[model samples]
Target: MEASPQYTLTERGPLRAALKTARPQEWVKNVLVFAGVIFSGQLDDTWAIGQALITFACFCAISSAGYFINDLNDVELDRQHPKKRFRPIAAGQLPISAAWVISAVLAVGAIAV
Candidate 1:
């Protein structure tokens, strides 16, 4: 039998891992933030549109931060899942300390926005 290739963490650079940790693909869900404006019939109001956009941005940042924190807490369990094992923290591509720092920054940004 042939041995499968082994990865020793840090497969990608910190920037790439950080981006993956952010999980931009999930941003599509933020579109729901615009529903408030649409339902209120304020689509033509620049202020409402701007508010919705800002809300969407904040939601994305906060949710991304939450995801990072959740991943940090579930690193060990995630390692047992075939797919989740490749997540930045679970796979050891991103350090727990760094994840905490990144998540804090993102959370603060979300609050500020």
Candidate 2:
């Protein structure tokens, strides 16, 4: 039998990675945001579709940013985690500091759009 490695909650962070890891939940919230327009049967409008796509894209960016930030902050704990031990940063396949910077940049870009 085996258990997957997992990340530990650290006291310090850039706050993005945690968000990314929990992106599915945030995505659910997005669904709620878009619900108003979907069942309204306005899905045929090109402009509406475009706006929805944009919204989805923005959320994707935000999710990515959160992932990076979480990876950066959890590097140490991740390395020690059973499942998380194999994560890019935890496994030394990625750089913690770099993840942080990338997340920050992505977050700003998402917000700007």
Candidate 3:
């Protein structure tokens, strides 16, 4: 059995790749979680703000998990595409098995929260 290739910081730092996997730019959509409190006139309440923040964080985690799963499912297909081939998983910057673990962890975190 052969071992899979590993990516080092020189090639592509795992941390950077993981962060990219999370798709931080899309986190802006989580802001909608606060809309309920904001439009309902509960924005001034500390408890409501706290809840909304928690909800936003959970949603972010869930969304990231979704991205991980999507990437895992598309890794091979992505490798065939010029642009998508550069993605962390398809580029071999991140491992597919690790992505599965991360996706499960994020999903559990979202559910627990």
- Give the 10-residue window scoring lowest on summed lDDT in candidate 3: 4-13
User: How would you encode candidate 1's per-residue C-alpha lDDT over 1-57 as one tens digit per residue?
Assistant: 998655433566666788899998999999998998999999999999999999999
Candidate 2's error at 27, in angstroms?
A: 6.1
TM-score of each: 0.81, 0.67, 0.87
Ranking by TM-score: 3, 1, 2
Task: Please list the residue runs of candidate 3 whose C-alpha ends up more than 4 Å from where it truly belongs after superposition.
Answer: 1-11
Best TM-score goes to which candidate? 3
lDDT of 2 by residue, 1-113 (tens): 89855554453233434443445555665655466468778778878777887787788778778777777788788888899887666766445676666778879988999
In candidate 1 the C-alpha lDDT for residue 97 amounts to 94
Residues 1-113 of candidate 3: C-alpha lDDT, one tens digit per residue: 99876776456677678879989999998999999998999978999999999999999999999999999999999999989999999999888888899999999999997
Q: How large is the C-alpha RMSD of every model relative to the true structure?
A: 7.0, 9.8, 4.2
Which portions of model 2 miss their true places by more than 4 Å?
1-34
The TM-score of candidate 3 is 0.87
